[model samples]
Target chain A: VGPGDDAAVLSTGADEQLVVTTDVLIEGTHFPSGSRSDLIGYRAIAVNLSDIAAMGAEPRFLTVALTLDQIDDEWVKGFAKGIAFCASKYGVKIVGGNIARGALSLAVTAIGVVPTGQCLLRSTARIDDDIYVTGTIGAASAAVKDGVKVPPLELNELWSRRVDDMSCRYFMPLPRVQMGVALRGLASAAIDISDGLMADLGHLTRSSGVGAEIELDRVPVWKSMDAEIAIEASDDYELLFTAPAKEAERIAEMAVRIGTDITCIGKVTAGESVAVNGEVGRIDSPKGYRHF
Target chain B: VGPGDDAAVLSTGADEQLVVTTDVLIEGTHFPSGSRSDLIGYRAIAVNLSDIAAMGAEPRFLTVALTLDQIDDEWVKGFAKGIAFCASKYGVKIVGGNIARGALSLAVTAIGVVPTGQCLLRSTARIDDDIYVTGTIGAASAAVKDGVKVPPLELNELWSRRVDDMSCRYFMPLPRVQMGVALRGLASAAIDISDGLMADLGHLTRSSGVGAEIELDRVPVWKSMDAEIAIEASDDYELLFTAPAKEAERIAEMAVRIGTDITCIGKVTAGESVAVNGEVGRIDSPKGYRHF
Candidate 1:
């Protein structure tokens, strides 16, 4: 495993293999300056988990390195709570961490495990595979664009209630853990949509040496959201994957069993680019979320 | 296997155990703001490797997350070269990494393996165990204090040449990998001296629920470097450990086999603090490197 995939896989010489991924979130870049520290912490872990999930692994351990401008007790407390909450919910353990003085930033490294040879990769999608996406997209981007304020946390709130709030979606995009594990032997290739659907799909296609054709009308955008925004905006944390068309029914059953909506919005092609057909027009190049 | 130790050890059901450690280095805090990118990269990986070595494990895989102000092609290339250089020398692979735009910083997570039940730890030192350190100390601190310029790299430089160069010691502290592996069953407790000898000794004693008495004259300070500087300054990256007094000759023989100096500096005591004695005077508190 190397840089072209969602996470790196290491053979442990056991029945299982290890999958590792790292991601960094900086204040004033990934999130606005002075945003809630807890949310920032939650987002950092969540994003890294998304990468592990994309590899069809069960996240098991995490190590955090934080760079903060000062040692604010309240901020540190909130940040730790956020990390703990996410870790506990995902059956992950915070095994190690370090803190240093600098501009506010959090770097999280997640380690996960999958049965040997069962890990998913971006370069394994086959031609004529059915392209699928989980849940609705663009809500988080819309929340960012609209400046929504994150709501207060209720520990036992229903998932439906949490997903219905745009602020929650923006600040706490849930990693599709169960769905990803379910996808292990079913999906050919998978990627989490952190850099927008079209952009990430383009990554999968390019890596697999295949092309994709999206039926724009079938994309599961958040209610009443523009399809163009759904296609171009990032930070959705949904899964975009491909499988043979014959597996569509099995995938739909798995989605129902996991309580996640799965939509067959496109098909893998034999060419080298992603094509979007329907009202939103076509894009030849990927213009994903640019950090700079 | 937790925060108090240099690295976390995870049980792998197989004959080997996994050791993981993470560290972060920011531009101004860890190094000069405009220092050489390659040196910065090398220092980041070296420091993390020191943590793994302290655990008496074979350094294996690494994941890096970088935050840069801008995507300078030359700077990135240089940084990559530096990382590759250090990684290759240690037989470690860069398994995964992420880069983002922000204030320059690098967070590296190193994963290594040790045989079952043989990992070194800071909490296992027994009273009456002889304390020892590998290689000379304080050269890196002296180089930083004197503002020495790092010399250009020569791929096949001798270990003696690199250790003799103050600038090289400051910028590229060689992780005592082989020495650590050799100490697996011989040493009772071990830690790397990144935060000065006395300070790290304090850490080891505190974790082991013991005290330590150091004979300042026995410390292997670099050349004519002040003994005070050797005890107080940071960034040595030498292994400080404890072993049964009976193992002295074996440890000496191992040192010669590994071609690294081993100096017996002190002994573990029955109490809870550290006492340093010599011409420089005695200190009771840990004043290790502070990043703020």
Candidate 2:
């Protein structure tokens, strides 16, 4: 049974060994208990997996940290079900974890891998690399903002639906798994859009030691939201990536192969600071969810 | 330089694979902020790592979950120093982690391993196993109690030193790495004593589908605290384990090899329930640390 062993041995047919990351979601900060137990559990692991995905790594295993106040079999069962569902969907395994007591929170550490030296990163972006993002953005923030303000009863079903962006992306944000895998050899640098595009791209530029000229006209926003609203709201969880200008067409082809949307937003420059249109803007020094 | 890559690259030789475990430590329950930051970091990783050591594993890489109200570089530095000291002490690598905003807490997910199928567990005890433990217990709890009470005697370093049990184990509870490795083939069932010995033994017996006879006379207590005070106090982080009755001498020799103290406290039987004498006594369940 391999019981009492130092480590749980997990074998992967792939060459590159493992990808690891951890994120702590607190009780009052990440979300209110308003989220279903199932989604909460799913998102707990999903967020960490997304970090792995952003590296273009295939998630194979996760170790979760859960702090609890009181133990309830049923509640634990629900949480486990959510975790199991995510694992099954991603072809990952729940190898091991610690269950301790405290204020309710989740700390998930996900590990995965790609070729030994072939993972994507923001540091690899060249000065002229084109910046692109995959799928819709800012829908989650809109969901949060609109979900709280219930619409009037006089509205029609369509109008009622319009009251909130129940795009299912906020409660259960999709990790760009296929897109990330496809970009393994295509994109030079990439990150998930946990914050706004401007903010995350700022991270990309800072890490890569380059600036970017992001034409607002070329930047993509959730078609449903007002352009200004989408620009400021974050929590998109989409893929914000940088690829060599020469490979932009190939990167687009990759997104097509993965059945994901791709939008060209900006191009890398030789200096520091992200410029919106032609002007050096605050986009270069992007600010995200500040929880001080 | 696999910066921002989809997956992080880690290299391990054949002799030493990766040992992995994740644990969540919360505030108010695990520690108060006034609790020494260095010790909090030390114990957060130490308690989680005790599981790995109990399995006879070497600690390698760690992914930390840092939740904070404000980003105090000093606190971060202290916490990092604590982790770095232990990681360096155990030859562990700190590769990557995420910093999130929330209540001050830590969830350290550590990875280390020994050979395949060599990890220890609580389900391996046999019918006639002689139970053994490494080191004095209840020191951590005593330390915790001492940490809260600020002694009123100024310029009394001797008295403060004499009274601070928390100063000993509370901040620096030892993980029984040597004893765990020594029990590879000698001990049958094993687990680190997170809960008190009696309570944790209850888990051991339950896991093995057996009962145990733990003589109150044989249970190990810290020199600084009386047996009565230590019984209910936990945070010992010692290895409470069982081996074949025939291997008692070998067990002692192995304990010597590990440079840790050992005591034969009890034996395993073919029934259910854990007890101090011969009956299932009230161990008080340690305020229920498992919550869902």
Candidate 3:
């Protein structure tokens, strides 16, 4: 479904619950100047899909509201193609959307579905639950750092390869949809790492009426990045969840089956705030990119 | 049902098909400079609900992606209250959404549900069907005209009342959801008049692979406005639909029962373009506010 219709009709099979989410990406704020149109489109949909994935559901439909500063045919074509590719990649359909004139921005809304009563929620995490996160963090932050202009520095093959890897991660975030779906019936609570683990974990703890203590040593970070900064870096788009401590081994096995690394990094506690290594303190304002 | 979770999960009762649509309202594009945030927020949701109404469905959930130039607590509170009021008015749940920093914009995605296989489509109008429009046109355009700076003009009670009515229509568009739902088994095809009569009718005719012949004198316009200009003025969020010629009386009765004015101004023809009277040609670029 493209523009021109009033609305799109989708068949939601009987006995299913619909999951809905939306995210915004602005050209001058979210991405740097001179960003590729294709990547911009892909990232818009990817972030919304990550939200759906964090719900432990399968994404089904996407509606994009795109505002372009000017009508560039090539840019529009590349953007459409990129959205179509991402939709196909994750089995989601581009259902309906609106195109308008304004500052360059993309607001994507994704719809997903799961079996009735099976959706994961941040309010369900319980005290004593083990916290886990998928994949490494800080790569996107590292990439954004490199994107800024700087004087040339000495580079070895190892450093050059690392930069290339992080840049790729920055442009193409992989949503752990499969891992999220598998975590259903296992994870007590789940959230996606978009506003950094520290900030998002605070949200989870507040919602669940519990707290968490992270073992910084057990957390994974991008090469040469500090564990604290990695945990505070935004745009990771990885699943962060909690499960009963006894199910930690089973969750690890599920991750292996899905071909993603899962690390047990913390434990939920009885409180309403998140702590680092049993020390109670506020998670400071994000040093990583903040949407607001 | 809020921003803390990954996504909002909703129950879709058995055998219902989901209808979804999205619309964006950008500062300086959709509204005038220094517009009230409350009205902006209400209009954003109102437009999307109008799309759902055109599909002959009942709105159930909404996800909004709001990007602001800067964080203003009063503006945010007012915007939230406006959205809440409209959601309560229409029974739409505030499912999930994102708030980010950037150009002031609100992208609203609404999801509705209709009986299985009964949702209306633009491509279903039959040749020889009678085309009808709900409500009077040109009021919104007139209101926008009056909003701009103007020299002092005499304001008699009659003219003052008329101006107030038109401005009310401009600020608060009543989406004809109930009327659309009632027309489900009656109207052949339907579309909401967002881009005005001619452009939207062109969309309907093209989708149905048919043509339309409109009688200029039969169209209802705001006081003293030309029929052509009224038909081309945007933001008159009325419903334009086609029904069998034989059922015109019944449809008119239905409109009466629903407390709205319904006027038959045209008929579907066995061709592929919309004509004013017997003159067949393009509608040309809109004289109304064009999005792009």
Q: Scored by CA lDDT, what does every candidate get?
A: 0.81, 0.70, 0.80
> How close is every model to the real structure, measured as TM-score?
0.92, 0.86, 0.90
Better of 1 and 2 by DockQ: 2
Instruction: For each candidate in turn, give its C-alpha RMSD to the true structure in angstroms.
Output: 5.4, 5.4, 5.3
- Interface RMSD, model 1, angstroms: 8.8
What does candidate 3's lDDT look like per residue over B75-175, in tens digits?
Answer: 99878876876677788888877788998988888999999878778889999999999888888877788883222232222223433466655646778
lDDT of 1 by residue, A100-202 (tens): 9999998888888888777778778999999999999999899888875766654335224558888778778889989889999999998899889987887
Judge the docking of candidate 1 as incorrect, acceptable, medium or high: acceptable
Task: Put down candidate 2 lDDT per residue, B216-262, tens digits, no spaces.
Answer: 66767887566545655777888888888888888887767767888
For candidate 3, lDDT tens digit of each residue in A165-278? 676666567888998899999999999988788878877888888878888777878777888778789888988999998897888888888888888988899865466762
DockQ of every candidate: 0.35, 0.44, 0.75
- Arranged by DockQ with the best first, the candidates are 3, 2, 1
Best by DockQ: 3
Q: What's the distance in Å from true for residue A108, model 1?
A: 0.3
Q: Looking at candidate 1, what is the lDDT of residue B292?
A: 10
